[model samples]
Target chain A: MRYFTTTVDLKDSELDHSIYVQCLQLRREVFISQMGWNLYQHMGCEFDQYDTPASVHVVALQNNAVLGCMRLLRTDNDLGNATYMILDAHLGRIPNLPSGIMDEQIQSQDTWEASRLAISSRVPTSERNAVLVDLLRTGMEYVATRGGTSLLGMMNPVFLRVFRRAGLRAYKFGRIADQRDGRLCVMKLDLEPGAAMVAA
Target chain B: MKHPIQEKFNKYGFVILAPGQVPSDAITTFSDEWKEVYFRNEFHKIDPVFEFAVRSTRNSNCTLLSEAQMTNELFEEARMFEADSNFVSVSHYGGNTMVFGGVNPELDPRATASIQHACQATHRIELLKNLDLLTDTQIDLMEMAEEGFLDKEIASEFGISLSAIAQRKQAICKAVGTDCFKSTLRLYTLQKWGGLVGEYT
Candidate 1:
């Protein structure tokens, strides 16, 4: 069972386009079908306005099968009324999430917001943690290599424990809100190039 | 474990090394200067300020080290690390004694209010930790539900009737005194951190 990770952009070649589609299908399966999050779906793929050309997709694959995936957007990006997921949620642009999710607005090239993190249920229970670690490690390294210093997202508090155990410096920055899907909190992970963390 | 309590104390020029299940688990913090020295030298043993903190009960221990107490080697060396002679500490005395404190030179009205806030936050974190209002099965049920398991899926996982799963979830919400099951799960996570206190996270 070989494991690897890859990053895709919409402007890339056709192969990257196919991988991105698989990522969206994986998101649909985990978020909309399983978790019941009211997200936009087209042809059995979950996505939102944040899925722009500027967005980068990090995918974890095992033996050519998509096991986990997440999306990254630089906080400085803007796409005609949308900034990033968390900031959009804070500004009341996203209806499902409660407004005022973050304390202040953030627009920095050195900061990126990660969202739509999903690990496939098809992966056996024993291997789920490994897949998640791979996906997160790749995502953090990708951000750090691109001069990103901080990664922000609204995530499950359970993942907080995962971050702590993995030696990633993460903390809940804002309030934890009870959403219909689960209890989510704004978590920030400070990324440093080649930092000490659990190996993928 | 890295709890938000440490971050709260850090905002006020205080440092809590790690708020564990016992009194000795704490280490001072002032933007990371005194932490190494405090832990390496075991300053808690000779520091009279820490002694006052250990003796405090249900109240904030605000004390200024006397000339005699300051003469101790801990205070003398700690001065180089920005440790002042005055300090304030708060505690939550339950099954375990957890202390959080920092040096504060100005005991003004805002500082007083901050002390009260620390006392309340400490009490609440501990209270939620020791609540134990839900059963083991109920706790598992909430966790599974939070993992995005549907009611029927949870019932199948637990090998119980769907109705029983619904009833247990309702019971969990009632036990945690919340109307929503997700809110109950939030409380459960807070309580779960108690067991995770000592472990590195």
Candidate 2:
């Protein structure tokens, strides 16, 4: 598996556009079609207000096809009327997430939020775990090398087991909220340079 | 593989919690509306089921919500929303608490035992909340312990005295709310694996 980062800007690169499209479609298939989440979609691609140029898209590819993807936004980022998604949710700006989900408000260059992680359902069951490990390792390295100390995000509680199996250490913090998608809890992962992968 | 506890208790509904003031991070199979009202109204503040679980010295609390309890203000308010009644509320409090409420009049003995095990597992992850308090050496000790290293082996590997190893292990246990090396290692593994990650398809 190969992983890379790109943005949604087609004009930025003629080469990245194809990969970005695959990433968006992967999200569309997972979030909207499979999980039945109500999201912004156009022409078989899923995106929302958070998908700005400042956002980094991490895509997992194998055999030249997108297998998984996630989006990363620095916690300190400010894009006009919005910050990051989790912070916005905690401030009551996002209606779907409860206001008190996070233990404390965070805005720091050393921290980033990883969101919209989706692996292709079509991947063979035996290979899904490898895809997840690669996707997370790639995302972690992307942030760790860029001076991030931690990664914070919301996830369904059951998904925690998969992370455990992958040998990634995640700590659950704050309250678990009943969101429209499912039950979710705030989690933090401390990062170390070149330490993204540990023997599973 | 499905969790054995989950499979055994598939017929029941419950909320499992770590050591926290509220059940905000509870693992529950309760209905959405039930949670909506329970959390929106901040009823956990007055929830007798939760109160019993939090205050009881015993490891387990098993009782049907009495007619008197059902008539109480909390349940009265809950009833207006068409919540289920004749409820049996069973909770097991370890480092974490598994509070199971169901309409069933009779609960299987095995189900309650499963709830207890779930609480234990839930608490194992909750122990990680204290990770920041542990020093680098203490953290390394924990990792080594999780890798199945014995106390003597770890002491030898770190070139520390056996007494020094014991001191650090005790500190680690106190920080994470475990009593011994075995449980502490369990907590470490749970923290390592019971975390959120990019979802697998």
Candidate 3:
């Protein structure tokens, strides 16, 4: 059996409650224990303010088992996606906040921030790239359908190389020290009229 | 809007390199010192900015990447050019596609506008190709899936065989490379109208 991707609305009530719990559990396994990001853990899952009604969760599944997942949030929405960009401000060091990209992103409502892309380390290496590519393409398709033109994310050097090599068009911008790792930078991928950057 | 390099920054530049071809455009405001360092370090191996420029075909509007978005190495090297922002875009005309890149000294509109209009207006024809397009039957199946319809419900509503619908759903899932039904529906919804959407004017 092959894998497929789907979106889970945090606000949807008719869905199986276990799937939501499974998402969180997978996130805890991949992001918390593996990636070591300092996210708030609830019931063994990781999440933060951006996990509101506005958040869009994309999951990769194999035989109904969660293989990987990622989240999307509109930058201009009240979901706190863009608001979280100002880490320095949150630390009372507003003086060091890099506001240049924010000033431009705020002026356009077509931008969304993608974060917390988690892939199970247990997934065989053969199936790993497919999961990541699927999640990314699904997210891009989602943004384009919403009349939005851009997708933003904080990517580490590893992801940066992967994206460029994947034939995805990403524009790297400001960098910040990762809370645990060394550093990561912001990237913007446009989903406008021409997405021809797909690898040939 | 009042950044010092606004005027020079808006003068965006572009060059067309086909797939698998490396960019050799020499027309740029930055000096050779940093460019050499950038290329020597194989920055292109991880340069998302350059990748973005070459991937998507855009209109004459300028794209802005703020300081917060810059990568550490890129930012450190860009500081040598005294650049604070990047104003870049790509476009297609006739059979030729080109990616444009330049500086935006600051966050000014006029500055970006200048860059957007800087492609020398060459190959002025709009591109005729479509990026990703889906079929009507696919769209219907996707919409039904999107509405939270069960496999049986979709079969009943469409007067189709349940196994056939199941097979279709399976195909859709494989095409999207995910096991999630919602993601398949989401992909279908996005591409139902054909993967191309106009600017949100």
Ranking by lDDT: 1, 2, 3
Model 2 / residue B23 / CA error / Å: 29
**Recovered fraction of real interface contacts per model:** 0.00, 0.10, 0.00
Docking quality band of candidate 2, CAPRI definitions: incorrect
Instruction: TM-score winner between 2 and 3, please give it.
Output: 2
TM-score of each: 0.50, 0.48, 0.43
State the TM-score of the second chain for every model.
0.47, 0.52, 0.45
How far does residue B180 in candidate 2 sit from its true spot (Å)?
34
Ranking of all predicted structures according to DockQ, beginning with the best and ending with the worst: 2, 1, 3
The CA lDDT at B138 in model 1 is 63
Off by over 4 Å in 1: A193-200, B1-201
Q: What is the DockQ of each candidate?
A: 0.03, 0.06, 0.01
lDDT of each residue in A55-129, candidate 2, tens digit only: 887776666677777888899999888999888988889765677788898999988998887777555443555
- After TM-score superposition, what is the CA distance of residue B40 in candidate 3 from its true location, in Å? 34
Q: What is the C-alpha local distance difference test score of candidate 2?
A: 0.63
